[model samples]
Target: MTRKKYSKEFKLDAIALVLEQGYSRSEAARSLDINANMLGRWIKEHQAQDDQAFRGNGKLTEEQAEIRKLKEQVRRLEMEKEILKKATVFFAKETK
Candidate 1:
């Protein structure tokens, strides 16, 4: 079965039920029809990340985006280096 995707706002609301509304984790999860363990994890994430919590798909933080771009650039540079190495070997053979 495909996993269900929760929106960031939904997650925040769920977290609020526990923090602001004083609902126990199990009670919140049961009332919301979600797993208690999942609710616990969401609470932890909310505590740690605050505003940055529950970033949905394709929405990366600035640091993560920069890292992704740098990794792509490194891969492209490595491929170019390999092509240049092959070209150098080809020219050296032709000169002999």
Candidate 2:
């Protein structure tokens, strides 16, 4: 049999039906016109993302604007260092 593929949102909602509305996995799969195994896989994938969503230092938030600013400063400093090294090398070659 040729199988049809569903969108990410469709898979997420199918998984949610079983988890949030207390539907049986089989029932949810049937109602959504998807395979039970696929629904189970989507649930596991969702749980994994939710678990690691905040594994970082959380410097991406508006409250961490200072942290973001410091990172940009460090990047600029590194670029400046590279430019200085190239200039020093060019000057040394010309003097020789």
**Can you give the lDDT of residue 17 in candidate 1?**
97
List candidate 2 segments past 4 Å from native: 1-3, 51-96
Per-model TM-score, in order, reads 0.88, 0.47
lDDT of 2 at 78: 100
In model 1, the clashing pairs are none
Superposed on all Cα atoms, the candidates' RMSDs to the truth, in angstroms, are 1.3, 6.7
Candidate 1's residue-wise lDDT over 1-96, tens digit each? 999999988999999999999999999999999999999999999999988889888999999999999999999999999999999999999999
Those runs of model 1 whose alpha carbons end farther than 4 Å from true positions after fitting are none
Clashes counted in candidate 2 amount to 0
CA lDDT of each prediction against the hidden true structure: 0.96, 0.78
Candidate that scores best on lDDT: 1
30: Cα error in model 1, Å: 1.8
**Candidate 2 lDDT, tens digit per residue, 1-96?**
976766656766787798899999999988877788978877887788763323344435554687778999999999999999999999999999
